[model samples]
Target: MKEWWRGAVVYQIYPRSFLDTSGDGTGDLPGIIQKLDYIANLGVDAVWLSPFFPSPMRDFGYDVANYCDVDPLFGSLEDFDALVSQAHALSLKIIIDQVYSHTSDQHEWFMTSKMSHDNEKSDWYVWADPQPDGTPPNNWQSVFGGPAWTWDNRRRQYYLHNFLSSQPDLNLHNEDVQDALLNVARFWLDRGVDGFRLDALNFGMHDETLRNNPPRQHFETEPTRPFDFQEHAYNLSHPELPVFLERLRSLLDQYQNERFTVAEIVGPEPLQEMKDYTKGSNRLSAGYSFDYLYADDLSADLVRNVSADWSDAGDSGWPAWAFSNHDAPRVNSRWGGENADAETAKLFAMLSLALRGTVFLYQGEELGLPQAEIPFDRLQDPEAIENWPETLGRDGARSPMPWTENDHYAGFSTVDPWLPIDMRHYALAVDLQQRDEKSVLSFVRDLIAFRKSSDALKTGSLVFLDTPDDVLAFTRGTDEGQVFCIFNLGRTQANLDLPLCTQTEIKFSNRSAKTSVLPETIPAMTGYWL
Candidate 1:
């Protein structure tokens, strides 16, 4: 079996915003099927679809009611099978989101568990008896806000929810629950899917002892919610998580085809947890964190510092990097500031692809779409509503994709989408950019092609080159060949003496960048590959 996922680019399609063919104002599986060709044309190896399981819409599809079947809002089982068939024919692998940590309160297991204390499925979810004063079990807080525990009148106990109250955390310590979750994975594997992007995986298990989390040290940036106030030592990231991951890895090894798994590890200590979760082949294929997703600024030092942590050692697991996702703000707005341009977008695309790991490109990223301004009245995300003025919320990043400029609804749907389409996105629509050769869309396509042709960029050892603070330089190489990559992340041109072979040739350079007669200067917001 080929390890195709290593250094491969995976495009993430939030089904709710990809394309809506159902006319119900929501994107569906058939909608994704309709755009497979467009996706394949982008030169990505796989597509990671966010959760489309039956959901109550409380936290959108993240609050899953069922694990095995497709939601009626998206499509039927037949539609999903057809999508897989079409994607496979296009030589595109399908990786679906697996929310193993929690399930919707509407799930049958949770419904039964909350019915009584001694029910057959009572131990399926994390439940605890409240203190004598009727407080929560511990000082843990949900990612959204407030206490992590919610009182359940039916069971006369409190249930753990790292996310919304409607989404209950599973008691993964129970052998029966583990077996059931494994069965869910088997069902999807039988459906011809390629891999899974495990969602909020670090929150899957908690400390059995229920100890209090220590207060976090003071930082320049203040906490946005109660979640950031503590060290999070006991609430999640249990020492036993790797054991469950090993079991998942063994399950994937049973298949004849190469099966892949990439976990989304988000916590106080994400970098260490990323390494711990994917240290060996017996664990996940790769794991990613919010390292780049939530960064306030992008600089040469930031890149160097983050990349330096993941060494090139054989036992270390591969890292997957993403600049933006459904849960975070767009990279252009976060990194490039308010007036970020096409050149800035192209630079980021190059930087992410040139890194030493798998890459995930969110929907509309190739089009250089900025974060949409979702008004308070139109906000649908629970987190955004709960933490309104403090945060921009995720709804802005999840606006509907603009396929055409002149379409009545930007070609997403005939009716207004679940989330409004950002009018600014229409100017950067796919149809408009597809016709312009110098557009960000075209640049990303050419960039992916260039990455595929370079052995160094694909699976080479990365070494940081000593350079000025504003300039980021690195070498990705093996015995067969080597590639030198340099990026001027600053706004002014940077002049530097580079350590390079006299016979070196420029393989690719962004539009704004230029090499001087002496090859000692790089224009701002430009990157070069030699």
Candidate 2:
């Protein structure tokens, strides 16, 4: 099978906010089908839709109630078929989100499992007897907040949940459970999904022994929740995860098309974990971590260090990089800070695309959208709400996409949206950017086109060049050709002496620059491709 995801660019869509054709203050599958042309025009290889399964809205759609069916709020399975048809018509692959670690408490499986200690599905979920003092079995903590174990009165035992209490963790140690999850993947593959974005793949299997996580080795920074206080080695990133991934790969092999799988890994030390998850053909196609998601600044060292970690990850191990996503603040706010500008966004685009990995671009990232200032009352994310005053929450990055300047809800819906649209984003609407010759949206489109055309930028090997702290320089070389990717990440202009020959051509640049620089000063927040 051909590895189409070698360096493919994936556009992520948060369905609830992408578009609302249902007029029910929420986006649906039909709405996504309506925008297939726009997504295809962005030049992305695939569209990764966030969870739209039948969820109870606890952790958005991450808490899945039914694995094989679509939720009414997002439309039916036929609506999803229409979406797949339209996307394939546009030559775009569809990668749906898969949440296998846990399920909504209301799910039929969980509902049955929690009934009694002798039920047919009793061993389907992680349940254990409480300690002598009636406390949880271990020191694990939930990702959202509070304890990882919730007491179930029906069984007189505690059910484990790495997230909300409503989301009970599945017992993958059971072969029956594994088979069921694999069947879910098969169902989606039969329904025409090209790939899957596995949510919290590391959390799929936990330490069956239920060992308490040791205290964090280094903790200079203030811990947000109890989850950050421990090393999370025992409860997450279990050693048996690769075995399960192999099973998933075997199931996907039954399909005729070259389908792919990407795992979303989060841990204190994620580089090694990411490598393990995508180590070989039997594992995931790629893996991404929170490396650049919550970063406060984009420094040369940060880029160099991350690039070095994945540079030697063997041929079979592919890295997936993303600077922004639905669960984190926008890169414009985190990296650009108070001086968020189009140039900064452009620089980020250039650097990310130039990396040696697959690319995942979140929705609204092409528009250079700033983080929305969602008030506390409007916050819907459980994590953001739990850590409000200390953190800015993820709701800011998940506001409705601004398609028009003055249309109702920025052309996302005729009625009000589930999440309030940021009124200030009107200036950066998609239609407005389409008219501007030098808009960030246009720059993103151009970057995607260039990346798709260039063998070096797409699937080349990355080699870093030593430069000043404010400057990030690297070379992407493939059998076809080599290109130099240099960026000025600093706030002030910095002079650099080029190490290239005078005959070097300036292939692409956010700003015009000399190819052969004896002493050329790079402007702030600018990038060049030579």
Candidate 3:
């Protein structure tokens, strides 16, 4: 079977903001079905839907109450089946988000586990007795804030929660817990999901000894939360995680058709962790880190350094890249700053596409949507709400996807959207961009098409060429052919000498002119594939 995910582009749909057909002021599975043609037309190979599982909505859909069922807020199991069938018909694979690290406090397993100390499921969750001082077991902190251990009076023990107190960490070390999660994966596989984007997979297991996390020796900047004050050594990235991944990989192999898994690895040593998690076929197919998503700058040096790190991993490792997602601020605003424009958006699209690996494109990214200016009063993300005034919060990146320009709600909903649609997004709505050939949406479509036609861009090896600062030059080559990719990732024009031949031709370029001869100087935010 072909490794369909290698070099494929996966469109990420944050279902809550995608489209709403049920008129409940929330996006649902039916709405995704309605937009299938739009996504297929973009030339992407797959669509990765964020969690739609049954949840109490405390951490949105990440706090899973039932892994095997879809949340009624999104739709029913039948609705998901229809989505899979429709997406398959359109030649687009379906990859659903799976949160295995933790479950909502309301989950039946947690409920049963908390009822007593010796129940059949009592050991399914991470529970420990309080210290002599009646405090949390260790100095570990929650990513959301506060202590990582939450006191549970029913069991007279504290439960571990790497995220919200409402989300209790699962005891992945237990064989039964691992088997149960595998069964959950099998349920979705039987339902015809092509793959999974494992959410926070590195946090699946913790140090069984419950040792305190040592404090960081240096501060990059002022720490935002207590979680940042210490090195996340004991709380996550347990070595036992790869053992569970082997079990998952084995389960996925039971099916006849090829199945894929990509882990979201974020912690103190994310780059190494990403490589470790994906080092062998017995584990995950690929793993992505927050290297680019949270970056404050996008320069040639940064891209070169990151690409070099991945390249060093060799054939045994596969990497996934995403510039923007539900968790981070939009790339245009984060990297391009206050004066981001169409050219800036196209530059990023070209860069991400030219890189060697699978790419995950967030919804609204093709249209170059900037981060929404969400007010504190209207914010819905708990993380943002908790760290407001200090941070912009994730709500800005997760606003409703604008479809029509004229609609008051941007056609995301009949009434008000769960999150406010950025008024500026109206100008860049899909309908308006569909009519303009020069729009960012159109450029992205053509770019994706260009990538689909080039085997060198898809699965070939990447080699960086020496160039002046602010200018990134590289070549992606395979047995079929080689293509030289160059980009000016700066505000000023850059001059460089290129060795070109009469046979050399421009494969694609963000610049308007299509010429065989290479220019001595390229304008800022310009890129070319030749």
Off by over 4 Å in 1: 499-503, 512-518
lDDT (CA) per prediction: 0.89, 0.88, 0.91
| Candidate 3 ranges beyond 4 A from true positions | 312-316, 501-503, 514-516
TM-score of each model, paired residue for residue = 0.97, 0.97, 0.98
What order do candidates take by lDDT, descending?
3, 1, 2
- Candidate 3, lDDT over the whole model: 0.91
Local accuracy of candidate 3 as per-residue lDDT tens digits, 1-530: 55989999999999999999988889999999999999999999999999999999998999999999989999999999999999999999999999999999999999999999999999999999999999888899999999998898889999999999999999998999998999999999999999999999989999999999999989989999999999989989998788888889999988877787999988888888888888767888988757799788998999998888778344548889999999999998998889987878888899999999899999999999999998878899999999878998899999999999999899899998899988899999999999999999999999999888888999888998889999999999889998889998988998887765224677667778556666787888888878
Better of 1 and 2 by TM-score: 1
> Candidate 2's residue-wise lDDT over 283-369, tens digit each?
788887578986877889888887777775455478899999998889988998877878778878888889988999999999989
Cα deviation of 440, candidate 1, in Å: 0.7
The prediction achieving the highest lDDT against the true structure is 3
Q: Which whole-number lDDT from 0 to 100 does residue 447 have in model 1? A: 88
lDDT of 1 at 282: 88
Clashes in model 1: which pairs? none
